[model samples]
Target: MAIPRLRPLLLVAVLLLRAFASLPTQAAARGGLDPSPGIADRKHGSSSRSLLQDQPEITEEMVRGYMSNFELESAIQDFGRRCANISRTYSIGKSVNGSPLWAIEISDKPGQREAEPAFKFIGNVHGDEPVGREVLMQLAYWLCDNYLKDPLAALIVENTHLHILPSMNPDGFALRRRGNANNVDLNRDFPDQFFPNNDDIKHRQPETRAIMNWIKQEHFTASASLHGGALVANYPWDGSRDTRKQYYGCPDDKTFRYMASLYSQSHYNMSLSKEFEGGITNGALWYPIYGGMQDWNYIHGGCFELTLEISDVKWPKASELLVIWKQNKMSMLNLVASLVKTGVHGRIFAADTGRPIPGSLMVKGIDSKINASGSFGDYHRILAPGQSYEVVASMEGYRPKRTRVMLGREATNLDFILDPDGAVRRTKPLRNDCGCSCNDNSNTGKPFLLREAYLWLYLLALFFLLALYLLFRRRMALRLAAHRHPPPKRPVAV
Candidate 1:
């Protein structure tokens, strides 16, 4: 009996050691193991050999149809020339390997600042996920080819400024790896809300720094980053305070849910997914991830962002890209259209000066605050429709204004005109140039003036009587003169 028990205990210890050995040491440093279903935990030191052995080798025939980094850049430049009237191409920054991170801006006014809301679509955040970059180029070509012919395309181009960054990790894509040339996960390099590990900007990767700076430069109202290995529209808060795997919603939980559903319900079959209900999920619920770009966007950039897992396979055949694009076309269009179709957009102004004021906008019960554009004082606040909200606009030197609005299915325009604090005292009194005493000051008359008022009244009465007598005498004299003058006028007529 003792020998059997010892043998069982030894076998259990051996199994435990093997299990521990399988987990890489870096897993603990990246905020414990990721429990997200269906997603390979490549960030946590998943073995490259095992990953490579699992997937079929990518042959030359496999990549023949796909655009390389060089081809993608050339295609973007060609698109810029082809659709120069409505679109322009520019590079935000270069990757660590000196690959230009190109961005195609599509709008009626490409580089000009307008009062309209801006939306950005970032693709290929991970190098191994090359589907996004291809799909993005297709999206650009589709919009360019069907602007006036398609009503939805016309609406997007006319109403909103759309920016597309095809591949954010060109170096990683070139190296045929998940991370950049530095081997750092771009998605996990953002400043985490709950963790201090990635808070230092100096240690951030170059791509992460470029994105952060780009957000600061452009006031994007909403954005989305594309990824692969699953089909779900993921919204924030991506990480939790305790780092536990649970459902964590951000401040704009309802609006984000509506946004996610808009993308999923419009998709061909994303809503039919058995894994994700409606092909949408809260990031933390799926699995808590620290230093994610989605949560950081909401917390720091004030941009409502979604991390979209667009494909089930990270590297699908190049020929299948068009089918994938077709499946996601409506979803992408609807997601961008939601910005114009379902938000409160307006400008704040000073009442006295009638000039725009860069004030802060806040909802009564909501914890978040969206600031107006510095130049135009314009703001686009995304909220769930069919509800009433107490919207407040505030400025430092101006009196805050609040309005009760009942938002319906359509977008609402609510502009606030704030009055300067203590404006009433500075107001000028109206002038009475007619010389009439409209205001009565008799109650506050001087003490001596009150006593002398009767004497002055009597003197005024005597003078008035004398003047009446004089007027009567003069009228009697004038009547006699008129009687004499009338007879002469009759003779002149004859």
Candidate 2:
């Protein structure tokens, strides 16, 4: 009898098992093992990965190994050498203990800071959160190395300039403490409702002084402070007890959410969305913390800011360095993507007053989205545009102004004057077929809430994989059938 066909089937099964072994246990728990419907495990096993458990564990030896073994300076220098039209700048500032604070500015378009939206990425904001420093170095290197190879990296560098400060508090990092050399928490030093002015608290620290000056002079579009010790991406305006919390985000909730969502999607956590359920907060990941850099950036600098608590490790280990890099490397890219791609970039004004509209102004249309023209009647949206947009302008007492504009053409611009007459008791919100979470809640019937881009990408990838598998299976079957059935060798003899 011919050899059994079971051998080939067994070989295919082994190859599949090896492929799945590389995926983390958590992915298996979440039903991600099956790349396709035929291959997925039917029975459930407790194999899910915990968001909190994914980060590397820290220890004294791990810290020492990272410091002594890894030549960070060399890694950064090598990265800088790989890209064209990219240069690095070092901003030397003093730490609380008079130590040198090394900051790097990575840009493809030199001296074009004024033209592009400046973005600042600061790491090691808290001494215990040392992982930020590693991730940023990796980011700097990857960006430079991949600029020519990756279109996205090239586009980001060409359109937006990045200022990456790998270590904001060198002294604190060196000391391995949460506070600066003066033993004060740098995060708490920001001027807030609780702490006003540089007077009593006196924000005289060199790190703060240098960055504050840079932020004011450059007019950065957005910024993120990189820290570890937590797994969630925390956002600003934390002092508000309810919705009216004064210290919470600076008069623009829509802008904040647009940027925050970018960070959430690039990471592996969903708890980032549950702010009211204790998953999100201001001070905490998903919660707003008062006296934070994010609040200061919005209130003082007029920039959107986000805090990235990179990893769950208290003091991350050197071995976990690559893991952190994988988790965080895409966030800055996503940030750049949001700045370059999304948002409604315009100003709202009153029709009668000819003054910029102040208070809540909603811009909508067929897209089923709403862009809030903040207190200054200035709304810059990174939102999706569609065929037509219906805009409504409203203030506490001012009558609402309503109009429609088609946005399918070039950039859409609309200015309105509100009459003394009050409009119909506020119209319903906008809706769109696009899976944009900003203002449009359309497609709720679909049940699944995946992003439009993600859904499309998923479908494309699934189709490609299915085709490859079918081709391989067909080839194997043909080979097996040929072996099982003897060729018509006897025909010649007949």
Name the best candidate (by lDDT): 1
lDDT per residue as tens, model 1, 99-129: 9999999999999987788899999898888
Candidate with top TM-score is 1
User: For candidate 1, what is the total of clashing residue pairs?
Assistant: 0
After superposing candidate 2 on the true structure, give the runs of residues whose Cα lies further than 4 Å from its correct spot: 1-59, 67-84, 200-203, 241-250, 270-289, 345-494
- The lowest-lDDT stretch of 10 consecutive residues in candidate 2 is 25-34
Q: 97, model 1: CA deviation in Å?
A: 0.7
In the range 1-494, model 2's lDDT, one tens digit per residue, is 22344456456656554543332110000001111111111121221113213344445786774542125555555555654368665555667777555556667665442224567788877776777778787787787778789987877777667778777877777676777787666775666554343444354566777677777566566788887655665666654433222334434554565466557677656245453222334542232233556777866665777777677666766788887788666767877656655543444444334355444435553222323333334443333334455555566555554545554413333333343343332222222222121211222222212224334654565566567667677888788898899788555653
State candidate 1's TM-score.
Answer: 0.76
Backbone clashes in each candidate structure, one number apiece?
0, 32
For each candidate, what TM-score against the reference? 0.76, 0.57
